[model samples]
Target: MGGGGTLFTYINKSTSHLIIPFEIAFKYEEKGFKTADAFIAAYTEWVGADVLVTENRHFLACHLDLPFKVLTAGKCLNLI
Candidate 1:
């Protein structure tokens, strides 16, 4: 963490290998967000974002195998 700040900016955005929101809408429902919101969340996870900035605490219910971190909007800003 040093004085270099967060390396979150180095995160990648996946154009391919992204989950199809329509194809797996039902599975996202288990996370408590609507289909549209779930799509965004799913994309965030697929993109390998360093942090999934969200105001929706319901994302905590997402049990998907995630490789990134999740933070509230405020928390994300603080890190920046």
Candidate 2:
């Protein structure tokens, strides 16, 4: 996940027409996990994008707190 974030940052900075897809990991069903909104919230703040896509259903439900639209699936082709 760290690698994906790093790559996204690099690609976004390097290319002018690149849309970076960021993954928000939710440890909701995992042990000792309280919040499943960390990654989405952080990335929304970090990138300031217009939209965010995730496969997790809980993320979409809790996306009202975020600035971007939490989509289920979308295209983000990295030219870099």
Candidate 3:
């Protein structure tokens, strides 16, 4: 399996992860992040995750003071 396959498997296995509250995601949206991006970011913070793995450049480029680190999937895999 390749990176994409590994990532897909990892995500599928994380289906048991907790869902973030709407209020938390809404707060991120108010900070100017897109809907999905806001939700992802909110969940990462709410879970106290060490890092956020995503390819969304806009989310990564944001200058917001996020508690968790945002990284590309490749970077995340390297760390793992």
Q: TM-scores for all candidates?
A: 0.51, 0.43, 0.68
Model 3 poorest ten-residue lDDT run:
4-13
Q: After superposition, how far is residue 55 of candidate 2 from its true place, in Å?
A: 1.2
- What are the per-model numbers of colliding residue pairs? 0, 0, 0
Deviation in Å, model 1, residue 80 alpha carbon = 2.9
- Give the alpha carbon lDDT tens digit for every residue of 1-80 in model 1: 88977657654445656555564455566756687766766666555566676676566556446555777778777866
Task: Give candidate 3 misplaced runs (Cα > 4 Å).
Answer: 1-17
Off by over 4 Å in 1: 1-6, 10-26, 30-33, 60-65
Which digits, one per residue and each the tens of the lDDT, describe model 3 over residues 1-80? 56654332233336447667899999888888889888888877776676777899987788458887778989887865
lDDT of each: 0.63, 0.49, 0.75
Worst 10-residue lDDT window, candidate 2: 25-34
**Which stretch of 10 consecutive residues in model 1 shows the poorest summed lDDT?**
10-19
Instruction: Score candidate 2 by TM-score against the native.
Output: 0.43
List pairs with backbone clashes in candidate 2. none
